[model samples]
Target: MTNSTRSGKRDRLAGAAVRVLHEQGVEKTTLADIARAADVPVGNVYYYFKTKDQLIEAAIAAHGHHLESVIATLERLPTPQERLKALVHSWVEQRDLAAKYGCPTGTLASELDKRDDGLDRAIAKVMGELLGWMERQFAAMGREDARELAVALMAAYQGISLLTNTFRDPALMEMEGHRLERWIDSLA
Candidate 1:
């Protein structure tokens, strides 16, 4: 196949993997499910990812890149406060998904933390990247306890995600999102 086609196929597979992995727990998602979601044959999955673990690695990388892009866009806003609020807003917009499946990174990390294959470290690093980004934004706002503030903010988010999913209520996420935005403003 041409390089462009090959790359497109792999990207599709990775994208599908991320979505499937988020919607279904990692324990339940199979290469066949990803192949179906990507509209590729199950046999062809081996061409790009030799094993399920390899595909999950690619998916996690894709998820990280997507997070970075979102953070970059938030950075374009004028102030640190606005950037942080925008980040919350972006997440709040996914309330329905959050209610259905919980925070993508949080759920994935929670599940993978049980494995002994070291994927727990990979997911932890992804979570750390998020916390680190939040910490930087808080630091820019002149917070002395930037890391603490970052952890607090993320704790609120993950907590609400679990509550929302457990209750099957998007309204819980929306309410908590507003509260988190207000809390960020208070910090400012």
Candidate 2:
């Protein structure tokens, strides 16, 4: 295949892999399934990603980085308080984005965690980075135990997302967001 054709194929497969992972979860997704979803040959997926784990890891990284970028944009706000509010709003919005792609990184990480320690460790690092980012923002506002606060915030988010997924209720998700907003507002 021409280089251009190869690149296009790789992009298609990667995009399809993301879709498949989001729909089927990491445990159920397969290389052949990804190829079928992408409308490409099975060999093509292998060409781009050596293993399913590689594809999932890449997908999670891609999704996680996209989220981080969105959060980073909120940092331009004047005060850490505003930034934190923006963070909360951005998170709710981002989870909606994840709904389009299926479950977010949190779900993917939870599923794959049992099967692969390496991938689990990698996911943990990504989560740590995200939490660390939040910690810095809280610390800027003179909040103590910013890291612990970040972890609490993460727990709140993960719990809300999981519950929302289970119930398929947008209102519940909104309530969760508001509850978290209030909690953070209290902190501020």
Candidate 3:
């Protein structure tokens, strides 16, 4: 295969791994599962990722890229407050999936934390980037306790996500999203 085709396959494999990891959790997901999801031959998965850890790392990178894309989309808004609200709204939009599978990053991080595979720090870095972005938004809004506010806001979402997933209730996320929007407005 040409280099371009090889790269395309690798990307597809990474994307598929991300989806499978999100759906099945790291311990339960396998290389064959990711290959099937990517529609590549099972053995071909080894061509791109030598081991499961490599595939998991690729999935984490894919999630980071996805997060950056979402941040770029939010950046198009007029103000930091509006951008923050848009972020909350985007989570509401994923209520159903959240209820079914939990927050993608949160769930993955929680599962990875149980293992001694050294993936915890890498996953934490990805989550930290998100918290840092949220903190910057609050700082832009002139909040004296920007970091605290950011932690509170993120904690609220994480709490709601856990409850929503546990109860199988998307409405909980929707309610929390509205509450978060109002809270953001209150900050301004």
Q: Name the runs in model 1 displaced over 4 angstroms.
A: none
Off by over 4 Å in 2: 1-11, 94-103
| Higher-ranked by TM-score: 1 or 2 | 1
Score every model by TM-score.
Answer: 0.98, 0.84, 0.98
Query: What clash pairs does model 3 have?
Result: none
Candidate 1, 109-183: lDDT as tens digits: 898888888887987888899899999999999999999999999999999999999999999989998999999
Tens-place lDDT digits, model 3, residues 1-188: 99999999999999998889989999999999999999999999889999999999998999899999999998899899999999999999999999999999899999999999999889899989999999999999999899999999889998999999999999999999999999999999
Clashing pairs in 2: none
Candidate 2 clashes: the total is 0
Each candidate: RMSD: 0.8, 2.7, 0.8
lDDT of each: 0.92, 0.76, 0.94
lDDT score for candidate 3 against the true structure: 0.94
